[model samples]
Target: MHFPTLATPFIFGATALAASLTQVSNYNNNAKAKPGMWVYKPDTVKSDALVIAIHSCQSSAQKYFANSKIPWHQGSDRKGYITVWPSSTTECWDVSSKASLSHDGGGDSNAIANMIKYAITTYKTDPKKVYVTGGSSGGDKDADELFGMMSNVLAATYPDLITAVSLYSGVPAGCFVSSSGASAAWNNTCSGGQSKASGEAWGNVVRNMYPGYTGSRPRMQFWHGSVDGTLSPNNYQETVKQWTNVFNVSTTPTSSKPDTPEKNYRTDDFGSNVEGIWAVGVGHSVPSHLDVSEAWFGL
Candidate 1:
């Protein structure tokens, strides 16, 4: 999946890049990951939205900022929003933990929630406009390392803290979890895309995260590469089934077409609040779709 360069080219020079990232030392006290936080504030304040961008395994926040094709900093500057990046001190995010899967449960998810609150208060960002996006390890389902755990776990554990989330190759919230509240370090069942369940069953997993929350559920977007052996495309299909049932929308997409002129880069709009993108020959981390994300986020 190729993420086309946006019509607005990236113009941030070395000085801007140098001035962009600021280290945030205090966000959470109990996170197992003990993640390091980094913030990017746009030069012009056009929007009050905040975006949390999580990094993949074997990657640091600084590396993600410098190398991710998603253009997070560029989007922050152009859209006049704040972007937060969290670097897990551990080998990976604590997505495969019982605590991380539960709301207010002390783990990486709680740490991320604290980070969001910190950013919102410190930056005066709109609490209602908070969003999240991530890719592989951080955003996907991998057999050896549990790739897609971050976005799924965070969104499930703290729906109220986020307005929406875009996941690249992510599985359902409880995909890495077993029935006994135990988490798998590597769940081949889910990673192979065999973690199938009824839409209601999967939806219940998300609802169980909060138990009794009555507020609106955050919207979601999914991106998957059809040929991605690392995290099979079946996970994406299951994700669509889960959210569609959560929204009480039909399983059938209202609209389906090529996202770009590219033949296999198809998009299926399930409803106003849910969308899925399928890339034919793409692999592990689906191509960055910041342009579509900006519009979805209303940035």
Candidate 2:
């Protein structure tokens, strides 16, 4: 082979590097990995509406995508909406502290919050339409450690970023009343004790979490199975009361839908939209559709 006098090895090396980078992109494209928080978009196309759906304990973002967990799937793709399912550092969100919201910034909550920001920045998600939801452990605390549960702490932090949150079989904020966390201690006070929280106790918790002047707090939507064995039914009703007090809505639901595809549901008219879904005959799972949540979020 003959080389041109002007040919240079450095030029050839640069071309090789570019080709390698191109190969990596092609491989990822074929692999179908979505950007930010290990999310899954209907298409790598575009979306303004975003759903930050966290998986239950021992689950991953891939599982949410595989099972079509939230309503952001199906017809949502065409509507310019996308859903993100992020894996916790170790299957749990550290919502105990506001700083935990950013990924690698601190606990799981920090990272998850960072993920939402990523979706918003990367996909240009609408701040108003932004929403959050989780399954059994996803919504509540992980039994393993009473992990920094989402519903318990969301009201306390990130009020500006997250518009609303949906909880399925979730735990209330005060379950961890002590500085030191232990499963046995939490289980004794919280496990199966489904008493509605004291209006003062929980209301104060939310108010303290969002201590500042005035602005609309994030709305709340709760769903729990009446027949859930792992979680107390009392907890379900109590959850409703907690949010009611936080939102300053009447304890009773204004709109109650008694018959769905599988279970009965209802929603109270809180100024900022706080609703509860009592699944008459379901378990620790997503009893209704994500579209139902869209309606709840007023999207």
Candidate 3:
């Protein structure tokens, strides 16, 4: 499937801030898919201090940003952060090949890198504060894939581009059940000896490729819902453990329940400034509006 172009009609209301939302057709000539980004530029802003590149699951860049309520104009008005939301080929991200299931080999990652370059070249964005984050499918599996791709290209194109990542409701790509019983409980899709072995191998590959990137691994904030059925909270825990073990960093995860209808769980490094939250009753949706606008930003 080819991504739709951004026509004047597509630019409605706040979407006008978008500089462009075009399809990138050159991912892989052989691939039968097209991916793109919903590029937003804050109006009346001359420069920006940060540029956030967002990755979405099945949803298009427009849908993701619209739903997430990431203010495009706010970047320019407040602190100056340009936000770009990139759409993946399939509803799910294909991490093994570092591309989308649409076979747009490297197209997704390339789009993000290209967008960042464009932002810097055009908007005078600070190269140092580039950050990445995703939720659900984008957050869970696609996040790692995007990171791996970024690690490979950022060094070459923008040597100074190092990004911090925050993942929500997703596990690192290479996690699986270890025992058959556990596998069966997980519906055997992620079980059996082969699944275990492959998962371990894949995990190790990710570790080696992205290691505990000192100064490279951006401060991470992971959030998951304890009751999430799509991706269990255990997956989030395992991912944190793996990352900490690999990085050899000491962190104390603090737990809490804020006084909202939905319970909130959070942890952080008291010293290093890495924090995460697991909303007790939330499902596969993005963090609550109150959390993102108030709690996350306030913190």
Positional deviation of 187 in candidate 1, in angstroms?
Answer: 0.9
lDDT of each: 0.78, 0.56, 0.44
Q: Which sequence of candidate numbers ranks them by lDDT, best first? A: 1, 2, 3
Model 2 lDDT vs. the true structure?
Answer: 0.56
Superposition error at 133 for model 3 (Å) = 2.0
Compute each candidate's TM-score over C-alphas: 0.87, 0.72, 0.61
- Each model's total of backbone clashes: 5, 10, 2
Best by lDDT: 1
The C-alpha stretches of model 2 lying farther than 4 A from their native spots are 1-36, 44-47, 68-71, 75-78, 95-105, 135-152, 174-178, 181-188, 194-196, 260-272
lDDT of 1 by residue, 1-299 (tens): 34345422444444455547888988645655467899988767778899999887777788778875648888887768889998877766766777878888877788888899999998899999999987443233432233356887877889889999887777888887755554336677888989999999999988888889878877888888887777667888889888898888988999988855256798888989898888888777676778877777777
Alpha-carbon deviation at 93 in model 2, angstroms: 3.0
Residue 27's lDDT within candidate 2 is: 13
Tens digits of per-residue lDDT for model 3 on 1-299?
A: 33344554565646645543343333223333344545565544554444444544445676655554444334434543456556665653333333321112343344455555656665576666665555343233332223322322232222235455555555544442223322102222321212333334433544544344344444455666666655555555555554454345543544433643344644444234345565766655445232352233322
| Cα deviation of 271, candidate 1, in Å | 1.2
Q: For residues 117-215, what per-residue lDDT tens digits would candidate 2 score against the true structure?
A: 667777677877787766443222333222214644544456667788776676675543434532213344565764356766777766665566267
